[model samples]
Each structure stands twice: as structure tokens, then as C-alpha cells.
Target: MMAFSSVTEPLRAANRVGGKEPYSWHLISADGEPVSSSSGFALLPDFAITSSPELSHVFVVASIGVRPDRNAPRAIRVEASSRSIPHRPR
Candidate 1:
């Protein structure tokens, strides 16, 4: 949540200063639903992993204790890998 807010808040601040909305974000989940954060707070997604929404970049915010299979369903992750979606595991 901090990572999301960190990036977004700055973009929003920039927009406020520049007078034009230049940055936006779309929260995505594996199943097109809400995902619970590390703090157990649910975050509603704007799209699903399979939706293939047009994007300049995709940031999979995996934190400590976040399992890969949970962040993204294994099958969907494999499918996305087959399509060559860029992702780096930390």
C-alpha cells in the first residue's frame, strides 16, 4: 500500500502543480476482484491479470510474505509468461 501511495501521491501532486493530469494507475488482481494487502486490508482492483489492459508498465508489488501463487494465480502467471509479459521476481 505504501508503494502504491508513494508513486500515485507524487503523480497527483505533480498534476496539482502542473494543472494537467499526467499520471494514472490501475490496481489489478489475479481474479478481477479485491486483494488483501499485507495488513489484511482489501484492495479492489481495476482489472484482472487476464484482461491484458493496455499499459506502459506492469508493477507486481510483491512484499515480504507475499506468495507468488497468491499474488497471481499459477496458471495465469504461466499464461502471462508464455505471452512474454516482463516480470522480475525479487
Candidate 2:
């Protein structure tokens, strides 16, 4: 999951309803470091893409105009392709 969206909080809140729903979520970033949102809030990712396991679903969330360049370092491409993750630009 990404840090800039309210999706995480809503999901967490829903889980508190107390059912059989399983909440297995992880926050990740490009450099395995903390990222600052456009709103100036900061969050640390749980893992870096390169070190993460091959996930069935991967979501890359970035604000509009904040998308990473396609010509970014090879490491980013490798990680994206390795997991078949979709690049959701904004």
C-alpha cells in the first residue's frame, strides 16, 4: 500500500468491525525509506520493492504529476516486472 491515500485507514477501520476478514497489508516504497506526501505528512514503508517477495498484486500509488520517470534506474524496472505489478500513475 502507499502512504498518500486514505485507503489504508478506511481498510483498517473496517477490520475493526470484528469479523473473519483478514488484513494482511504492507506499506512499501521505492527506496525503503520514509516518503513525504504532498500534504507534508511523512510515512515510512515497511519494505523496499527490491527486497520484497513476488506478490500477486502490487499497487504503486503516486500523486498526479509525481509519477516516476520511465527512464528511472534499472532496479525499479526490475522490481516492477518481477512482481508483475501495475504502475498506477496517480
Candidate 3:
């Protein structure tokens, strides 16, 4: 939860203080459902992996430690990759 806040708050603050939405964000999830945090807070995602738009940045914020053997996350990545969304420019 803290990590997600740490990353998002800055962008939020920038938009607030700058009086312009220089940074925009969307929460994309594998199922387009609410995701629970490490502390158990649920965050409703804006789009599903398959329904997300072409994103300028994608930040995977996982507060919990995930074992490499976990296949669910990997499956989500695979589903997301099937989209024709172009990669963000470097």
C-alpha cells in the first residue's frame, strides 16, 4: 500500500500543484476488478488487461512478495501481451 501510494502520490501532487494534468494515470488489472493491497485495501482498476488503452507507462506495483513460481501473475502478463497496444516510446 505504501509503495503504491509513494508512486502515485507524487504524480497526483504534481497535477494538483502544477494546476495542470501533466501526469495522468490509470489502474489496469488482469480482471478489471478491485485489487486488494497488502494491507487489504481494495483498489478498483480502470481497465482490464485486455481492455486497456495504449499506455505511456506501466507500473506494476506489488507490495507483497511474489514467488517466481506464481503462474497467475504470469498468466495476466500473457493476456495483456496479446493486445495490439504499441509499446511506449523510450
Query: Against the true structure, what is each candidate's TM-score?
Result: 0.72, 0.64, 0.74
- Could you tell me which residue pairs clash in candidate 3? none
Residue pairs of candidate 1 with colliding backbone atoms: none
User: Tens digit of lDDT per residue, candidate 1, span 1-90?
Assistant: 776677678888999999998777788777788887788888998887777576776666755687566545685667567678676687
Cα deviation of 14 in candidate 2 (Å)?
2.3
**How do the residues 9-63 of candidate 2 rate in per-residue lDDT, one tens digit apiece?**
7667778876655655677776688777767678788887688765666555677
Lowest lDDT sum, 10 consecutive residues, model 2, at: 64-73
True-structure RMSD, every candidate: 3.0, 4.3, 3.9
- The model with the greater TM-score, 1 or 2, is 1
Query: Quick one: ranking by TM-score, best first?
Result: 3, 1, 2
Total backbone clashes of model 2? 0
The clash count of every prediction, one per candidate, is 0, 0, 0
Q: Each prediction's Cα lDDT score?
A: 0.74, 0.66, 0.75
Off by over 4 Å in 3: 66-90
Least well predicted 10-residue stretch by lDDT in candidate 3: 66-75
